[model samples]
Target: MGAAGQPWSYIQRFPTEAGVPRTYELPVAAFQPVGMRMDPAPQAPAALDPSIITEVSVFILDKQQGPFAITITGIDAES
Candidate 1:
């Protein structure tokens, strides 16, 4: 989940085998931030606020130039 007005993006990477479908359970707390502010100015919160989460996205992180297709069957969030 991506939160609004956040400086950092959270991510959890899972291992996969080609052409094999798998179900992954990623804990919200386990999501690590990729970027952080290092300026001398006031700092932003490192944690993500669940209340402000506006979207969730799935994509391939591999830096390759090619056409790719990913099908998301469903997304469920439990409190």
Candidate 2:
């Protein structure tokens, strides 16, 4: 969960296919900050700092007891 040796700063969870392979595009603004909401009122999340994102991870939450495989074809930073 750490990025570039720094504590997890942002995260986003989404559903994905079990076996089928596909690509996912994540915009910079889509990731929410990781922490308690200090503000009592709702507010928009801050933009993610792409420079600090030195790594990318894909975690499978399926609880089936067996070996699992996940293939990440590529990771790109787009404007």
Candidate 3:
């Protein structure tokens, strides 16, 4: 069975002198498919400088349930 609470927001930061790269992973528990009440939607970072972002990838795993993984590649200002 699914969890009760809404999915949690995942955030990771790669600190750099110039600018830090960041990645976020949101689990399936975060959202309700449909015909169901979804707690609070996961929130991503506010405004992120596009220049620092070199690449971004999103992956979804559907086995017993649903799981999502997101990876972001960038160069921090410090670098």
Residue runs of model 3 more than 4 Å from their true location after superposition = 1-45, 61-79
Residue ranges of candidate 2 with Cα displaced over 4 Å: 1-6, 35-45, 62-64
| TM-score of each prediction | 0.68, 0.62, 0.21
Order the candidates by lDDT, highest first — what do you get?
1, 2, 3
Query: How well does model 2 score by local distance difference test?
Result: 0.61
Error of 2 at 66 (Å): 3.4
Two-way lDDT contest, 1 vs 3, winner? 1
Candidate lDDT values, in order: 0.64, 0.61, 0.33
lDDT of candidate model 1 versus the reference: 0.64
lDDT of 1 at 16: 61
Off by over 4 Å in 1: 36-44, 64-67
In what order do the candidates fall by TM-score, top score first? Answer: 1, 2, 3
lDDT for model 3:
0.33
Which structure is stronger by lDDT: 1 or 2?
1
Worst 10 residues of 1 by lDDT: 36-45
Of 1 and 2, which scores higher on TM-score?
A: 1
Q: Which has the higher lDDT value, candidate number 2 or candidate number 3?
A: 2
